[model samples]
Target: MRHVLAAATLAVSATACVSTATPDTEPKGVVVDPISWGPCTDIVRPDGEPPARQEPGVRCGKLTVPLDYDNPDLGTIDLALIKIAATDQSRRLGSLVFNFGGPGGSGVDTLAQAAKMFDTLRTRYDLVSFDPRGVDRSSGVRCGSNADMDAYVELNTLPPTQKTREAGRAANQRFAELCKRDASRLLPYIGTGNTARDMDRLRAALGDAKLNYLGMSYGTQLGAVYATKYPNKVGRVVLDAPLDPSVTFRQRTLAQTRGFQQAYESFLKDCVKEGCELGDTVKAADANVMRLMYKLVDKPLRVGNRRLTQGLASTGLAAALYSEGAWPFLETALAQADKGRGDALIYLADSYTGRSKDGTYTTQMSSFPAITCVDSAERPDEGELTRTWKEAIKISPLFGSEGAGGICTSWPVAGNNEARKVNAKGSAPILVVGGKGDPATPYQWAPSLTRQLGNATLLTYEGQGHGSYSSGNKCIQSMVNSFLLKGKVPNQDVACAAA
Candidate 1:
């Protein structure tokens, strides 16, 4: 059921502590405060675990934004924010905002965890990020209780039988109903369009004439939409591991399936060469993984008081595939699972889903369906869903259930989904980075997004994983640094060999 909606894309880190309150009257401008910053305390894991580490000089605060931009009288919600100032103030550039993939990912939390990656860029630009509306600590959406969510997330969306299919449909309906009950007020205004508007407001507040941004995965979608709406306001933008918004829902799903299939096969090939315990041949490795997936469907593997179901297992595998660095952990998890120990795979699954040790879930999963369902208007008929599911399995039997009927089909509100033909005609040159082996946001999307932008340069990472710039590739890093730091757009598309 985790993949029943669009692919969750990137794995985010950390959380923020913020609160919201409304004013007696509408403000003259965008609903906002002066953003009084302080030391970090509540940066959290998805499961409510306390943050492991908090970087010094990294300040946390809240930005109050309109609950409804068009109808400003509706009051306001607080967006969680984090900022690390530039090191070289004498030559400091403007703030560089970032959105790291999940439409539901916490920018504040992610910025906190990933700030070290941008130390060189931080020498000039103030690294900033926030939780968009309807994300964790930003009036985040809530569907049901912890127990209810557990049952919902574990539902067999890839039902092999009619009964399981019916059960899954029932769960989807219930989940949607719960969302409507819990977060109806915030649902309509949380789409990417409003977020783009919010970003502009953020820029104005930061005293910047234009926005400099680095967006990855789903964040690229947010960045592209922003450029289309505020082309004149775009400064230096980097869209890494970009998503091709022009693709139809089915096309995206299938393409993602193929991308992951390729990555998974690549992993298997490596496992064989490394003489991993999984197998000695690619076919055998594939069979071993598939065997584990199929076996867990009915015979759940015990992990203490919990069990590793097929849904969670699939999610864990997909999560590991997001980054090549996690391949070793994935291999270990797979080997452990083969011996009837599900702890390792379960740990990976919990990390992906943001499940805490306390059995509470993070707002990421709840907000994921809420935002994606509202953003996507596609409600394929049962026939179409069945066809998509069949086709997706063919693309990758391991992850094919993702192509089945998604939560959006049963959502209470109809999405105002557009064709997403973004052409930021007057925007500054955008640097689009694509990973050749990106599984979530396929490498092809990099070039596709490049074409979609009115002005852009494509940087292809001839490598593996979900994102390029964060892969620690000096070539990718150098090119992206030049683009953002110096505003130099390459005359032609560039490709960097995987490190």
Candidate 2:
């Protein structure tokens, strides 16, 4: 659901009836059922990853939502959910829902892994997260086999030539065919609007009068769509690393290209100050990185039994740019790559792609394409894609041309691009968190979304990362906590100094 840094990163099967309702609209007579919680079982994990920790007081449940809300009788799908109830029940406000981005990110798994981070907030609210429709354990979409995905990620889409463009399209078409073959029934309904509707359903299931949410990265997009559809239901909402709903697919992609370029430059400057081995100056370090990427295009790097292609290298680099703390690792990865070892870079790439040591891939990769293709409406023509790629290369030669039209170019289903202008008039106050150096969702989009949601306030974190609250900056956390906990909306936009 983001700028496709590489075809590999642009990465589910479901059974249900075709959706006949207008996309993202809740039809009359909709019903919400209470979730039946029990011991956490059936939690999906990467092939080699261990099972979810059995945290005390944690419960797991499934919410059954209509596969086609427009035509409820069509069928139903069960959404996987997890919850850590408030420690101080007497002081509890309600359940606080979270969407950890990825459009396809498995909230069930993420919440369980990162629950410790929310301990303070959990004292007054049950921290809840779910694998939204078309995500893991929720009728997640699956495409080709692990081996097929291995080939898919390594497909080179760079240099924006006729040959490379055609190859990219062919690979996308093949991957799309696999998804259609595996998940045709559910593909048409896997957009943000439906997921937002699922969130409303979730809110009702949790017995909340208003929806309280924390959404980061692409999660911010999902939150915005929800506010657009159910403005009055909006409670205390915090959208960190906000995505601008107003931008078209191409515009978002181009902006991300520039964002990543800026983040990379920032990283290089830090590396130089630290006396990094890559170069003595930022410009030289950048050129060396470009040279490595170009070299990998023709000669793959060997990491044990796996080969690292240029596309995977780019994915690894982009993944690192998501957080400033990862810059040191990126520097180390680059240094090792310069020494002809690709293991470290491959590790970063695998982390982003969710590839396990045993070679099985997570459903997130499959669902990413399913969700993004339907959420984004820009179906650019060949010429348009070529032009965008050219512009991207000019913005960041190392990262710009990794993706052209992304998997959407060959998607089997059309996108609805719901609520492009999300004017959540009269909605409850929202806190929009923007990290000045965020590479994935740029800082500029925060003000854009805050302005659109008239009742929202902008909280700027002068930091470098994809998210703000999770950055552990006390100033940011305090402000966000105050808003989520006590409904303390800042009278004016506030900027937190970087720590």
Candidate 3:
């Protein structure tokens, strides 16, 4: 899940120095004081359940970490944490830390809402989540006001023409300028490598012997980097709907385009079965959808006070592709769009971009591109992306280019995490789960991640949507539960039916 080509998204760690590590790889001088935990304050979930922060016994604290790991004495920034303490303390298995996907998403809310799902584990393990640096509650990246983001996201991203791409780049550059004005200090240090270092500090602060981790989507990439960096400190690991650590930014975009195409097929099948007004065949419906997008590109549709542009329409479609349950919403949006109404899709797009009904926003929009641009180094320029425009359309005329026309390459800072494989050698087995029809991280990425990791097991769910675990796939949920609970990995890859 990306939105308006800006969602190429955005943490941390275990460990001692590996013999092969360079000077930069070893976090020798870095020191963090132990966190003093206290009663948790209520934190509104940026993109999840908002009420969990008020739950009893929930604890919140701030861990001070080096602003730049390479320069530990420079200064420190606080990484926020939320904890649900273990109930069966006598039989506890230490803490299970989490990194929810958004590179920009807050982990505090993710773990808080998920406390009930692991009822048994909750008694045996302390559930913990942290807002990685540059995310919510942490050193968040603040660009311009919500009005600025509203304007930026509305910039057209379709057709990939030189003129339109430049316009998009110019608009993105303006947003980047706003970020540099407000958040330039955190920009350079917001890479995933730095985030991994922060995680190690968190692990040490918690007084845990080893890290028990559960990461999803972009979080999986963070977990892999952490495992590789701190091989000896790893415990059981679960990477669900993972990103291929070695793929370049362009490769990731094309893959996701195809992924969304596949997911759209699923949505189309379900919609046609349910007798929607879209069409009778995939070709007819898809063409109509493409025509709608092109129409929006030529002229945005005004629905109430907001104008629904191609980017918003595409983002709305991409957002619903994230979960099968949201597919019906897409159908309704499409049918309404057919009747010259864009309210449903506008609402959906607003949801994806973290916009409120009152037109405000969380930090997800700015931080998404900021953290993403810093993590990977291969964001293409206008020329490179334009060259691939035809092939991108061939892969997905609707979303093939969502990964293209991005303004990351035009940012103020450079990326730190280079394109490479993450081999967490000399570590415990890492479980990699893939949703067969996951549009965001894609299904094929799991196999790539599974192979890249030194010790990894691939768990496949033959299903539609972005993630599998705890999304109603009992086999996946059970398999992951067993792995996290008993340190077990499947003898071979386990495949499950759609949930």
- Best by the lDDT measure: 2
Give lDDT: candidate 3, residue 169. Answer: 63
lDDT of 2 by residue, 1-499 (tens): 1111221121100011122223344446657788999998755342335565677888999999988867878899999999999999999999999988887888887777667778889999999999989987999898989999999888765555667767877888899999999999999988888889899999988999999999887888788878877887899999988888777666777888888889889999999999988899998998898888878989999888899888898888888788666778889998889889998888778878778798877787899889888876768777777788778877876666664546787899998756455767668888899989888888888888888777788999998878887777899999999999999997676899989
C-alpha TM-score for every candidate: 0.92, 0.92, 0.89
For candidate 1, write residues 155-245 as lDDT tens digits.
5545445465667667888989999999888888888877877787788777788899999888898898888777778899999888887
Name the 10 consecutive residues with the lowest summed lDDT in model 3. 6-15
TM-score of 2: 0.92
Q: Which ten residues in a row have the lowest lDDT in candidate 1?
A: 14-23
Model 3 TM-score relative to the real fold: 0.89
Model 1 clash pairs? 47-356
The lDDT for every candidate, in the order shown, is 0.78, 0.80, 0.76
Q: How do the candidates rank by lDDT, highest first?
A: 2, 1, 3
